[model samples]
Target: MIKVLIVDDDFPVRMFLNKIIDWNKHGYELVGEAIDGREALEKIEKFKPHIVITDISMPSMNGIELIKNIREKKYGCKTIVLSCYDDFAYVKEALKHGANEYCLKNQLNDKILLKTLKETKNLIEKERVENGQYESMKDLANKCLKTLRQQFFREIINGSWKEKKDIREKIKELKLGDDLKNKIIMILEIDGFHKLKFGPHMRNRQILYNSIMNISKEILNDFNDGYVYRVTDKQFLILYSVHGEKSQLNMYKGMKEFAVRVQKNIQIYLNINMSIGISEPIYSLDRIDEYFNQCKMSLKSKFYMGDHKIILYKDIVKEISTDPIKISNREEKELIFYLRNCQYEKINYYIDLYVTGFKERNVKIEYVHNFFRRIILIINKVADEYDINPKDIYGEDTNPFRVIENMETIFDLIIWIKRNIEIVTGKLRPNDQNKFEHEVICEVIRYINCNYMKDITLVKVAEHVHMNMSYLSHLFKQQTKNNFVDYLKDVRIEKAKELMETHNKKISEIAELVGIRDRRYFSKLFKEKVGKSPAQYKKTIG
Candidate 1:
């Protein structure tokens, strides 16, 4: 099928273009709909459509820039410009930039659109047949194309080819196309990738890299113009034309879904974790490097924001309250009480409450760092007063005092403090071995109860408890008289039952919120465990 991309700033215009023709019947596939030229550029590269129908005037990357960018990428596709009668000047400019034809918007009709599409199809088919003549040197041509593509991505994204002539020459030589403008640039870094001491079975870096790319492509298949390119050994840049989300809120929600899918797939398939820093949608091909830098700045949020999150540049708003975050004496004394008594859960609650309060206000980063640093210092003070060496708990090299000084986020600080608390608690009060083991099992159950809605697994829980997988499993089974998996499922099933009884959500949504993505599997499991299907249980409760 002849691939076709529709680019227009007006939502209605884009829709009109889509409905103007029965594209499939005319040997065309509607690959994507982009709001502006910049987004159109990204779509062009991704879909590599035979024809691009674009509006002459649009925000961010306008039609003129789009045509120029398409030419620079050496994308040999017909560009049909949608223009107003008064936009004849822009229409002429678009043609000069390599737009193939102009369609007056006021005079737009199916006949005009179909004729252009048919002609573009014929041109693309002829070119394809002509290019087929190079079969004798296919391998040589493929090798050259691959090398060119690598060099171009490296040069363009890195800001080395800023000159128009140089960029144009490279695009022609490489036969590459770019439909990227003011698109959201996502910088994804595999957490602890370089630090990973992989065994022999995972030695092939290319295989691992390809696996990552495959996962990204599959998850982002809906993004027709999304381009995932390797930026660094540990990082990838995803230039995705942000569309379909509808509103700013939905855009963020979309990015979140994108991040979740990538993170979930990576953890499941590669046994690896990754963090993504997403920039606010940007325009201008020349500004890619700048946007990448913004993404880097966003990643810095991880230092304080924690990992496995999609940090949006826009959300990094700095509306700092003039008044500093000061903990009252009462609050300090309460925290001290929890720390002294080794009430780990209570400590976590206070920390979360404080963090949530500050975050809701959208305090400055410095204030967040100061807050966590002070909290850690307080912990250190406790250790000193009790004649306890924190080094004993958090290894000799990782002095919590020293780490907190450099730590960025409250989340990281909480992790450090909780881990040390566990170590110190076990040591300071190990006389009650039975009680300590019971506490460990209880913590495991608490964690499951809290995080069962997330993609939690035995391995994740084991890590959270800081115990060997086997050891955690044994303890869980001993304490609960049920396997860890069974306990987790029971918690989820119970929660699902509660939600069903309340009749607050659809059964499918309840299944998803309770961690099961497959509604059928959830139904079957619920019936097997509770002696009734979810629907039956809900009806009985009602």
Candidate 2:
């Protein structure tokens, strides 16, 4: 219920007004009352009422003075003035002081008072509804802009915006002007986006999206009449009108400086590399799709030119070379040889060369996936020849298989494979004939180490290892002579003990670095595993 504060110099006037009006029926309640304007001010502070009904003539302060003070303080309260005289001067003073209505003492009755109260409530409710609608519209606009940005980014990354009608509709919805006179499309792509991997539960995707959106908003705030939208997961489209027929080179210089500011302010590890596609301002939105394609092609130029830079499509026209980098029979043999011999570094080196070559030659990453699948088939045949378990060699549990699904870059896949291969081979003692079992243990250990921040269960470990959940549970116990969950806790405790030896870092930082995201969970695990909380352990060490 809306709260009302009744104030008047006369006690009888206050009591009679209170009894005459049905405050509840009028959607209000007399939460407090005062004899004079000064007492009313005190009660206003105490009750924080939404409406104030007061007499204009009072001691120490008048109704007009009280309303003036409230307005000066920016208090959101409605006021109605009461006076014995129906004088125009009193009404004028009250209105000037932000009183919503004026009333004469002799004219006051339940009918007039209730009508005024209901009217005030309706006005307040109307303003609230209008504000809420504005908020909803703003939210919807933001969401639509985000979706368009994602679609645009995907097209740029995928090398073409095939959906022309959809692009045109988005541009129209954003109210982006068709007087593309001096308009340019710049694609700001974050370098090494594929290298930054977050586990599924980390919600890293949303974090990255929010970061890009916030950074884009900050950068675009300088443009008086331009829209900046995320064109993709890692790219943003900046649509701005170039002021006063600036030279293309001058515009490029300005864009580069803006990108540098974004990098400095955002603090993301990757530098912003932009590919600018300048369109001869066309009068039609249909032409935007063509320019969008050109902007996308500019991003592909980064594959030919190395990192930490910008590429302009106009500048690279003559040098735009496209030569297909076919996976020759000999190259395939060499790649397999590196994988089989466990030369992981060489594997990654070749993968980078392969991906770069493909980008330069206009070969899509999906096509490269097909090539890799074919190579994997050949590798399986070789595994069969050597009588090695194909499942263990190219196992679904292995990082190579998982990386193929998650990682966009060949380098990422090679790195995962290399690390797993090292764990399989380097950590095994001589005469350990059960190499596959040893590899599974190493994978489990790696999972435990990587996920110490989460509640690591045996089922989760087994799922990662791609074994029957229960069968792996029994196998893990037999192999380690301890339950899988216990082993994981022991591993976390051991890491925590090492962290306690360091005097500088906080216990929380150590907990996070060791894979425990929650400080409380880390402390609990520390207590469970080491018979003491993390703080206690630190104190004991100190």
Candidate 3:
């Protein structure tokens, strides 16, 4: 809506102007009214109206002085003068002070008022289009400058800006200030574009994005006073200027409103939702990229946070503790083993158990974030060991963190890990593994099925088959889909179950028969797999 404010000293005149016009029907909203130019300035600052209709002369400040003040403050508002005086000087002076139209109080009618409002609307739209649209080489260059601005910002953020001298020159050329002032970065992206009604197609997406951006700029114009850039097809970057004495919380409130406004507008007009990630206020022009990355990282908080609102980096820090964490060497080895053998389900189980452990210990959320990153790093390392490049698995320019960021569940993470491992294993050894290894694995599986109650080990099996332990270990996972110890446990657990049902043996006696030395440890593994203890399993049997 184009906000319109009216200012006139005569109460009847203000009422007459308002009652005579169907503002909404003509695409204008009457935001407020002021009795004089002095009051109008206050309203103008508060409402940030698009069109101001005011009397030429009034108490304290007059229309001419109001216009000058508006110009000094850089308000892009179209003003219209309404006056009792039809003097030539008053008309020329109002026109000279940036009034688009002058409607004399005596001559004013519905027809003239409507015509003036329409003309003002046409002028505003034309000016906006001229500022934005590409009609020629000059227009195109102007548009490219916006794109170039984003490119330079990306270069600076990505640490490519070479020298401080060059930085200052470019900032001067772009009219960017040299002083280090507090600035906040926000990254907003349409939450679920594919699910939106008019998405996927380039043309439709562009129209939707442009409409949302324009609406967002209109809402934030008075508050943020910053440049907005299209950093990615789905994401937009906003460089927010921090003004005097605004607390960080107030900034967040304003940005939260900005997000809520965008969401309301997009949903109302385009039927879409957006997620905004806001960075903490920081100083210096060069650290834009760092702030941007912080916002990007916070954007991933949406996976844990859900969608359709604003999330602050400061709050994200508060939500996730800053406690340092380190993954055990054993955990990395196990994850790599799963990735190597294509045992995706086990990989998932390992991750689930580890996370459950964290919850039990009350570990911080940042650990959860770091945990996934470490897992991905482990996957990359294993791929490297196999002489496999990750791009072949994950695709070029693939941000594994981003891929995981949107994951809503452990099951989703499992699916992602599974797919990545399958891709790498496909490229590394697409066909079935070595034939001798397959033969060795089959022999081991048969041996385990026959003598699961015996004290069994990978070495025992490898020696029984007269094979190298390492090669046999590799083959055992390839053919039977289990590492030696896991497969042995599986066999022993099944055998123990049979002993429990038919033999009526004590739990410890059954544990002994399964080649498990510790009955307590056997029950722990049993509960993990069967969801019941050996005694509990035996009690259910008739």
Candidate 4:
């Protein structure tokens, strides 16, 4: 079949082009459509169309430029420009750039289009024969057919083809099946696929994806009653026929068995884990989108059910309840108090209680998600109160919300939360209180040393350390045997003495360098501490 691509910015124009011709009936396949020349180039690379039907003007790139790029890159495709009477200049330019034909948009008809396509087809055939590339071209066309097949199923699952007749015609044209009404949909998803895509372990994402696809195809081929389509980077959709099953229950059992085999094979061969979501049998072809959604919803149960398991839509309905997880005001206070005091034992108790409640009530998955997010936020709120960054407890790169969203199971969440809680409370536990206070004092001194040349104040320092000003003042005096102001004054005086000894400068300059704005105040303070005025001290040092 001759492959054709349509590129136009106007939605109605593209739609008209798409529907005006019975492409498959007339030795052509409408491989894909794009709204602009840039996207058209991408489709050309992927679909490798033999001819391009494009508007003369487009956003990002125009038809003339697109044709130039095709020729420059040796894509060897013929172009037909769609233009209006006012676009004569653009049409002339496009033809000069090797556009095979020009069609006036207002006068476009199927007969005219068919004639243009035939001429384009002849040009393509002549080129292929002269270049002796028939076998290679044949291979590329077959690959395009496979891509078209996947696109066909993806569109149906996404509800892109809303009309039943269009779907039926495409399915038959693709030779997928004559009857798909009695089918089951299963979504097989790779666990932690994002990690693998970006993770150091699987550096080549395409290779990993292709290997998974091959494994899926090999396994499904053994069953001989199912077909698989790549849904996303991490997911594959399986459409299985229940033709031989005597009952729905039998079909479900067969699905479970198939899923287990797939998981085992992937784990053994690729060293990767997978999860499956199985939907109930569909008796109508029109509800493929609804059934596909059922599979996706079932897959979400894996957030609590863990990975490497098959979740049945029927099973989830039996297991879940609609109740929202709740916390009373008193309960909230209790949690806050425990967090403030670093009472880890109590925190553990609460964690266990929440997990137990979730399991016993069989709470909805969304409620669980909400509960997890709320708990993390509460933890963050407490951390902020202590001037502690949550990143220090978790890793700097960790995003609590994203972690919660992607966590595979309740157990995974519990482990992460408990581990972070231990870190937070361990730093503030009473047994380590003296050490923690000493560290705080050291940090405060370092802060003073660094900022003594600025407007240093107890309030600013306290805020920097995330401590109460009074408490920080008391602790500073107790630990260093000097109050906050005395320590800050001493640091400035020492800096001033160093400057006076090292560089020849005025007393005012020296005072200002040490963050003392008034030279008289600096002299008085220096006399009291160093037993000499600024000029007298500088003379003695000289």
Candidate 5:
């Protein structure tokens, strides 16, 4: 409808104009009234009325001034001047300033008013067409239509539209077909799209988005009945028509097949994989929001199922385990113990267990946010114990929680947490400790050399240097390019070879002398290190 705003200083005149005509019946809407030219400009900007009616002489800016101001601002609305019999000069001035026509207040009637409005409307449309703005106006109308459709879709998905009458009216007004009543809602997410946003393709993000959106549209067009809405940068919501299908089984199968084509085409054409989550077909439009949630929840299965697969809502529902997922106090304590002790292997193992438990239990992505907080809290506790500030590991500019929030999968979350834990725990010792890294490794080596004849373990050597067993183990490997245990074995094997050359002792005696009580185990180690069993080497030496 063409919006109309009336501007007049007279209150009764404004009221009469509002009450005189059935605006909607005449394809016009009297949106608002303004006291003078100043107020009219504000209303024009706010309502964007297509036609503005104003009286000639008024305070705080006259109709002639208003017309000139409207022309100066380039407001596209047509203006009509209202004047008294004696105000022809003012009306002429108004016309000179861009007023399209004038009506005498004394001669004003519904017929004349309607006639003037119609002529003004025709003139405006004709001018727009002549200036090549007709198509632009149509585009604007279409844009508005699209916005309404998107809003309605959001309302249905959010379950906010309650009145069936309103829903039907919107459905008719928006021209969304009756087929939408029985539809499947599918949410498509570009796999690892979030990572790409700040990665190598960050500059061409719009191109990537346009490519994905275009591919989705082309593939859906092939299916003959679906609409796609970009819900976010990395996610699109699709409404597919399942209007004629009789069998629920067939409907889902068709939806799945369509989903597969979309997934495959996007991957093939764009070299980008996307995961689709298809909602169960719903017969009622109002139930759309519920199924839309199902689609989103289904997509979370990617944490376990990985990307590029079509996840059906039905499959997820059937497999939904009511068993709650959380790290038990005992499990949390165990993880903390491993972290505090700088047990890198144990820390890595427990992180995997926690993350894997999430996948195994089919935990919702929401729960994982809390799980991230829990793990970070546990790590921070160890950081506190060591007086190591978390910022030292996480960095002042980075938010660890935000990083976890952006993670695409639980596995990614675990990898991130494990890395941060390693950094934090590796810093548990004083700053000066790093200065003595070589000394620490040499001391460890000297201890092993002196004690090669006795039983030696990583724990025993860690006690000798009063360093963390895990850190010392890591340092030993970093310094000597071999692990402590392997180094100890090498030391013992070398001493045993010396004994073999200097003495005529049996293999078992030599093994016992080097702290390898298991003679067979010694022989295995000796053969591995020396490329021969002890007796074979002894005979060769002889």
Candidate 6:
């Protein structure tokens, strides 16, 4: 219900106005009445009415003065001015002071007053909707501006923003001036960003972006003037003005330490590898763009130097004189040859050589992934030519071609690739010598199903098959198209799911029956495979 207040110096007028209108029927309630505008203000504060119907000629404060005060106080109430005369001047003044309705005292009636009140309420609601829309638009504009700033920073640091006039215009737009003389740029990239799966349900992009922005904000809070922007989807640009005491290098080092601390403290935290680019101190605003490019070059150095803690513009320039050699096709083939042989030590040696070579030549991480992808394609082609199943070679849980951790040695990668290839291709040929391999696989599967409640391992399965553990794993995948561990887990999960659906078994009992002693691990595995917990699955069946 809408609350209303009536203010008129004449007691008879207030009483008549109150009685003439059926306020309750019209979805309104008369909360209070005051003889003067000053008294009306007091009642307004107490009642917090939605509508105020007041006389224009009141002592202490009139309708126009009261409306002015309400507007100043930002009260979202509708005001209707009551006047003895239909004077154009009084109506205009009341309207200008945020009054929503104007009524002449002589012409006052229930119909006129009701119609005026209804119209005022409609107008009030409309304004509220429009105000909400304005706020939404304002928020969107701020987000767009932030994105634009990040883009500008990226372009400037990369030396793409070369035009003086363009730089000036951007500076004017961002309102950054000579005051930001001690500006420092920090380029932060999420480690294993490409490995992260982004799908309809997985909002990885937004999560990473928000995390980086939040961290940047925390780091720059102590600095008086600083701004953080998403330079790219993967990288963030933090622009901060260091106080006179701290050098650019010192500030960059501090930010690196802060980033490390944050990563350690936050669970599921991004292993953020940052490349800080420190520009020379600029006294003039015109050189801001130039320094930005310098910082970008510094960041680019990370591609060659690997995950760098800090890179300065001066260091990039110093190393610019010599160009490093690119990895040759012959070298790549040689590395693959070593990998195919399972020469783990040799593979490490070559990988180290390749990484060192790339560092000397300044190859970026993006290029490295591309190069590795090409190598994986080649390995796949080789496997196909040899009639080898690629999945059998790589196993189920691990990617043979993936570069794990900071293994910069090409030799180590080569050995990993070879071992995976051998695993897949070793079983491509028929078991001419071992005629009992298929029977062994069948018996193993039967044993796992029957004794799933007991602790089982590859060794037990191998012993039951009267073969070595490694050979049994190879034969299992070759025959069943899955790894031993994965197949075992799947069998256990399926049995648990069946019990949950057909039998009235508790979750703990089901987990124990599946050889899963840890209830939490059982639940996690159940949810991952079945898309719900054991209890949830039972509820659905019921």
Q: Model 6, 1-542: lDDT tens per residue? A: 88999999999999998899799999999999998878888888999999999888788998888888888887778999888664668878999989888888889899999899999889878887999999999999987876776677778755787789888888889766753666655555543355556777547678868886786687567544667777766667666666564565776566556545544433235544444565655566777776766766776565445443366676674444234344578977875675455444564456556656655655554555555566567567666866756654554575644553333333334334444443433333234225444777766765675456679999987887799898888888898889988988998898687657544445876788678999999999999998998878888888
lDDT minimum window of 10 residues, candidate 5: 427-436
Cα lDDT for residue 532, candidate 4: 88
Cα lDDT tens digits for candidate 5, 445-530: 54565456668888988888899999987788887788877877897898788767755556876787778999999999999999
Stretches of model 5 off by over 4 angstroms after superposition: 1-136, 158-169, 179-182, 198-204, 243-254, 268-271, 318-333, 352-357, 387-389, 428-542
Native RMSD of candidate 4 (Å): 23.6
- A best-first ranking of the candidates according to their TM-score comes to 6, 4, 5, 2, 1, 3
TM-score against native, each model: 0.42, 0.48, 0.39, 0.52, 0.52, 0.56
Model 4 Cα lDDT, one tens digit per residue, 203-294: 57777777777887787777756677786778887777777788767877777777888889888999788988988888776665667778
lDDT value for model 4 = 0.80
Candidates in order have lDDT scores of 0.74, 0.66, 0.73, 0.80, 0.79, 0.69
- Which regions of candidate 1 deviate over 4 angstroms? 1-179, 191-206, 217-222, 241-264, 271-275, 285-290, 293-350, 384-391, 399-415, 429-542
Where does candidate 1 clash, by residue pair? Answer: 41-179, 41-180, 42-179, 42-180, 182-282, 182-283, 303-409, 304-408, 304-409
| Candidate 4 Cα errors over 4 Å, as ranges | 1-142, 152-182, 197-203, 245-253, 318-320, 433-542
In terms of lDDT, model 3 sits at 0.73
Which residue segments of model 2 deviate by more than 4 Å?
1-170, 178-183, 190-195, 222-225, 231-234, 264-284, 306-309, 317-384, 388-542
Q: Give me candidate 5's TM-score against the actual structure.
A: 0.52
Q: Which stretches of candidate 3 lie over 4 Å from their true place?
A: 1-141, 157-159, 162-165, 178-183, 192-201, 222-224, 244-249, 267-273, 300-309, 318-350, 356-542
